[model samples]
Target chain A: MDHNKRYEICFSKEKDLGEFLKEAKGLNYSSFVFFEINDVLDIGEIETDFRVFKGIEIHKKDIGDIKSDISTYRSKVDYLAVKARDNRVKEVLSKDKRVDCLVDCFGRRNDFDYVVAENCKRNDVAIEFNFGKLLRCSGYERSMLVRKFHRSLKLVRKYGSPLILTMKPSTVFDLRGFREFFSLIKSIGFSKEDLIYSNNYFKRLIERNCEFDKDEFVEPGIEKV
Target chain B: MRFRKPSLEDKKRYIGFYIESEERLGRKEVLNELWSTGLSFLGEAEMAETGFWVHDCFDDQLIVEVRDGYVDEILAVVSLVNEIKNERVRLDLLGVAGTIRKLKKSFILNQEK
Candidate 1:
């Protein structure tokens, strides 16, 4: 039976595009989202069955800086992810419609709560869950991190925020198959339907971003005549 | 030790998973990581109660047995293990079944192919 297996978009900074593509293909991912546009050049040179997309991840401490950065990089990248260093910046960016993804909620603290969840839902900003965190941490800190993720997931569910699962792998060694990812999240309390939704969300993001890149597309709702 | 009746015994689930890595890992390394991760996360007392076992281990794929209610915990432990002997690795879970026979028949054959 066909399981309708999900396609993963790995965010990698690894310089060797050929090796990265080989690893990603082995992991069954059809796409790789690079953190910078420069790394994406060699991707075109390598003959592969994977689609590469440029993404910009900004780490900002203030809302003003974030707003300016978003404006500068919004049209330049296919995916715009923000790692808010301050809780206030996170709150503002979570509610900002221009922000595509709000990641690294566990940067300094467990930055998720009912309020942030609500804002993300209202703005349609995706709440990203990175499995790489679980890989790095262990013992008491890991337990606490798991609890924080559980609590955040509860709030995200209650407010109905879009959920995104990412590996954020820096190298080929960090890549993982979709089933491995699902198993991790499934243990964290997400249902099978939720897993399916996460996959669909990534697929939709790629499609939407591709549409936005078109010259004929004027904006979210407008088009050139 | 007195054996419990079949109905009195706890129901179990078998999880089929494969290790994703370039280097081939031995069964010992896989078990070591599994126990280390499981013990660190769930603690020894809780892990013992889960009745975890490596039902079968192949070159790359393996089937782990766990108590019905504790499958999630086992999954958490397995997924958290990204390294073994300082080598990077990833565990991709294929499927879970009530019986090892069923799990193999349904998932193992397909994966082997």
Candidate 2:
């Protein structure tokens, strides 16, 4: 993990892709990951120094359907995020190596707990702290979400699990720099060290995916000897 | 009048921030939202304790001066001010310094990159 550089993962609408890249670079993000919300997939030719990545985010769906979607999309993209609304889905995704991130832990207090945290840690599925969702709410709802965040971070830290942070920015305005992101979440018990680990874990994820994509690679332990 | 010793003087910090938004933002609108956000997040007691103040906002950058020990608290509040006048905005911490002059010279003007 180059501590000097930071990375962000955000969601983008089709029209905002160009400006999103510009804002991300201006904010000093070394890398930007995008999960297109719509059919705006013309992302091939953006002239910029920053490394851009494309990903898939699966929202709340039936367990069997979600599993099929995961299998279908997992190998195709370097990043796969599953929104596990059901505990069964969460359990399945927690142990699934194909899924890079398990999200939608916004169900007040029922979503994430110690068991999920431990399983995610043991199986290497990262639990995500989606910041853009937090930015969209206000008043009581926002405060309630922050309280849930406080609780969730406590459980995540207690289990020593891998944590990842993403903005899910729909527009350019939703993106934020590293320090500000750190400070805002720190109030809810996230530490600077945790932030570094999250960012570095993400960095490693990209590298590992790149290696996994090469023709010579078979799986984690063995290459095509 | 016996001045408080330099060592005993209240140490301060100036936090430089860049506001990222689609439209232009003015100091008045930004400051108003900041105060409200800080007040709501920290409440009146902590807000008073930190003694937060905005030095200036220009060219989409702003400097917030807070007590040395309270920098993080003020930062949290500033980060929470995600909107100003119905416009979505993001506040990114550019840098923080012991003096406003250094913060301005290094961060606002951004001589070093």
Candidate 3:
């Protein structure tokens, strides 16, 4: 593996796709995962020189709705993320292997229990750490967010749950280079190697999805060559 | 003057980084804001221990000198600085070295490329 390469798994609601792609190249991001793609934003019309992956974020009220959204969008998108705000939603998302990631663990009010962590490990759903919150929040809120992340990190370590690092950039301003992203997460007790592991998880996710899309692919362990 | 012991000398690290923004920024502006933000994020006691200094600034690029073991804390503080004077900006790390010579050889020389 080319260890120098860094992958950004989430960039959301980009206004100018073309410009963002150019910037992404300059930043040396090997791959980018853009969320909430629509018809107006044509992926084909734009360039695909960089490894770009499409993802849909599920922000629903209940677990049932989240599951439905995941099922609906799973095959269509390269990555699928659920915005887990509370324990109930987190629990529901964690138990499902189809769900790729569970994000927003440090929302205004959220719960991250050991059971949820173990569930994520069991089901292979990665827990996301968005550095955008660290950039945006300050004072007491930022401290609380850091503490929450620490708690989550501890649980993740204990349960061996996959951890993914995303900038969660809404605008170009929020976009950060790999080193900056690495340093920020490193400060939060995430080692550089952990960041690499998380990115590899996303890479594997994309590869798995691509395999399923192939015509010869029949089922798990049964592919028509 | 008596020669200072190597062990007694502060084991400092030179970190090379650059700022990305729409408009060009003066060195003073970037340095001042970095210090202020560092103070705010790390507070007085921690900031003092960090011994952070803007050793050099050219164009949008800056080389910051910080004591060893405090680089990550200083980096965390720098990441928190998203905006300066209401202008959006990002501080990206280039490389870190124990001495200025190596840092320049690696980051400064290749910065143009």
Candidate 4:
């Protein structure tokens, strides 16, 4: 609360994690969540001055497969994300409190409307703003990506949904410090208040998920079947 | 060494920065790319007001001079510059100061040595 919004998510599948963590810490991040599950990439024993969490991202396309994967990996991981292309599947994941984030894999055909954004807000599921592709492309490709992001940002702001901004870095060089990251998002129309809102949401997400061992934990807005 | 009145002169800032690259880059290439990227982000009119200049750059330690009230625009421009000559790079802010002397003393000098 006293400091900047210095939390991040690294989706790196590479093994050069030592350099990544060093760059992250040097760039003034206080905490980071890694969304890869490989045991070989473990940095638990590494003497780091920042917090790191193990997260799992489910890429199942079928609705049934997604539900199964969420249940299977929900408890095993500190954070859980699902990529759903079907609107119905997106709705299902939005309504499911067990899911932490919903990754928008649907490309330029952008399917995230006001309804999806509102649903995510109602369910507390965060929408990711991945700048990896943006950084990789140039000219027309980058322009189109920026246009797509503007549309998503408009909906996210209107609905007050929990939003997470990340570069989706796969390497140390791909990473950016908090200042640069914030500036990039701000250029896309994200306001300072939006950044603060995101910071508080992450704090809450981490606080609730910290007690993962207990069975009594209940996600807000969930009802008994 | 008669100088113009302080109030009549332009107020500029020497902002310190660093470029982390996959390989060493030339001064002209780096500035050319930065100016190009900065122009795209700031547009022609706003960029003219910036009075932007790459005061000195060595071993990726960069110091840029810009007009006042445009610091965030500079940061945003620097942030958007992800590539230079097809090499992926990251630009980070070191600090901001009113003069080159203080900027070197505070941000770049110690790190370089």
- Clash number by candidate, in order: 0, 0, 0, 0
Clashing pairs in 1: none
Model 2, C-alpha of B94: deviation from truth (Å)? 3.5
TM-score of every candidate relative to the true structure:
0.82, 0.90, 0.90, 0.87
Candidate 2 residue pairs in clash (backbone atoms < 3 Å): none
On lDDT, the candidate that comes out on top is 3
DockQ of each: 0.49, 0.61, 0.60, 0.56
Native-to-model Cα distance after best TM-score fit, residue A69 in candidate 4, in Å: 1.1
Residue pairs with clashing backbones, model 4: none
Ranking by lDDT: 3, 2, 1, 4
Global local distance difference test of model 3: 0.80
Worst 10 residues of 3 chain A by lDDT: A37-46
Tens digits of per-residue lDDT for model 1, A97-180: 878888778654646777788999888899888877778888777777778778888888888899887667776666666666
lDDT of 3 by residue, A138-189 (tens): 8788788889888889999889999888777777767776666766788778
Q: Which ten residues in a row have the lowest lDDT in candidate 3 chain B?
A: B104-113
lDDT of 3 at A21: 75
| Each prediction's whole-model lDDT (CA) | 0.77, 0.78, 0.80, 0.77
Question: Which is the better candidate, 1 or 2, if ranked by TM-score?
Answer: 2
Report the lDDT tens digits of candidate 2 across residue range A1-225: 467567777766647576567656756578877775312234677877788877888875687877887777766676778877677778878888888888886575456877788988988889888876666777788788778778888888889888887676677667666667777778767788888888889999988987888898987988986
Query: Mind giving the per-residue lDDT tens digits that candidate 4 earns over B1-113?
Result: 99999998889998898888879989988899889887776688989988888899888889999998777778877877777888878877788899999998988876642
* Tens digit of per-residue lDDT, candidate 1, span B15-91: 99878776899999999889988898778998999999998999789999999988777877787888888888878
Encode model 4's per-residue lDDT on A1-225: one tens digit a residue: 435746777776657666678766667777778886322125466568777777877877688877887777777777787876677888778888888888863465647777778889998899887776766666687787788878888888888888876777776777776777777777767777777777777767876677763565565444245
For residue B105, model 4's alpha carbon misses the true position, in angstroms, by 1.5
